[model samples]
Target: MSFNPFSLAGRRILVTGASSGIGRQIAISCADMGAAVVITGRDPTRLDDTLGQLVGDGHTAVPADLLETGAIDRVVAASGALNGVVLAAGIAKMVPFRMISQAHLDTVLGLNVHVPLLLIKSLLAKRSLQQGASIVFVGAVASEVGPVATAVYSASKAALLGAARTLALEVAKHKMRANVLSPGYVRTPLLDALGNTGAKIDALLDITPLGMGEPVDVAHAAVFLLSDASRWVTRSLFIADGGLTTRMSV
Candidate 1:
């Protein structure tokens, strides 16, 4: 047996949202660990950039929008068989509950929740996922602890935790595992887009014991969940917060 259980050699993994941010980092880390990664994103140029950052060969870039129903099957067909799948794509809207419109709700839930669920189902049905494959879904700390202006976003993320738990039970028979990676306010483009700047952002960091986190922080956790090191770990949530959740008041 190899001494390094974290090595992903001989494994083929699929990573969604790999054009940038946490997803991009996950793809890079997977390749560094010796996995042949298939990365997907809506941007062909950014996907090519991620592909360029990978350390090894056999890394493929599939440019597709995961929000489209038609894209799900296409992603499955392009990925073929895989030892791991990481659902790192998500959307968030931080607005007061009363102001949230139907379109807003749909956009948030559609990309964050519905797309991953359907994509997972498509991959499983197509046998695109090999037995004993690891599945990691990116969740948010807001799911467990509520934050102002994120009611719908919180709901969408919480839904993933519930689904992942049930999925773990259903897929255990096939030696496959399902888990969630919940990250706190990381310095990603998504955060910036959500208006997590100025004093509001400073306030968040003030409460966090370990301060701000980088994309690599989450990528390290994703690698653990994907590697054989976590073969016994499943149906669980691995939180990579910088102590923000711990310092939250009730």
Candidate 2:
């Protein structure tokens, strides 16, 4: 008997932060796997660009900023029931600890931590997540690496890791799964925005044996977590960092 556990046919998924970068790639990859994808982002134009790139039909674009209190509710309400949910929307900045401000902390934590948590809450309230559905929270290697100038970013991602683990236990009764996907350095606009120039990337290559990863690299790992292939997987943090952690640990 032939079997392919990764097929997402007939699955309906909601992917947040799908306007660009990792989230955009994840949305495209999920659609490639035959899932009906609903992608959300604050920029309607970028979301439309992503929606246009998706392979299959029945995909939707809902523009909403997760930082807003009621925005998530509207997203879930429009999505209907979902077989998977990928919380890939996040904010990152390289600000020195000495320069960290209250506003900075609030903005980082609000979007990275509170938004995803509240979004999940909204989904649950609306019964938008089907039984056996999978949840994927996109964390970052900064949480584990403790890099310089990423105090709040690391904390926010660490909070997500902790929350996803707890959510896994709490949602067991619903036959749902939750996990975190932590990636090292990926080539995205966000990375460029973080001031990672070619020189910086060359420096990073020294520590990361496989060099910088692509958005699709992280997206593939997310696909596994969101697909039936990971039916028995939950409360796990899947690191797709191309051996950065391994090298750093040595």
The CA lDDT of each predicted structure is 0.91, 0.91
Error of 1 at 16 (Å): 0.6
lDDT tens digits, residues 1-250, model 1?
6489999999999999999999999999999999999999999999999999999889889999988768888888889789999999888778888899999899999999999999899888888888899999999998977777889999999999999999999889999999999999898898887764332666777888999899999999999999989999999989889988877854
Global CA lDDT computed for model 2: 0.91
In the range 120-185, model 2's lDDT, one tens digit per residue, is 988888788999999999999889988778899999999988899999999999899999999988
How many pairs collide in each candidate, listed in order? Answer: 0, 0
How displaced is residue 155 in candidate 1, in Å? 0.7
Clashing pairs in 1: none
Q: Weakest 10 consecutive residues, lDDT, candidate 2? A: 196-205
Residue 131 accuracy (lDDT) in model 1? 89
Which segments of model 1 are wrong by more than 4 Å?
196-199
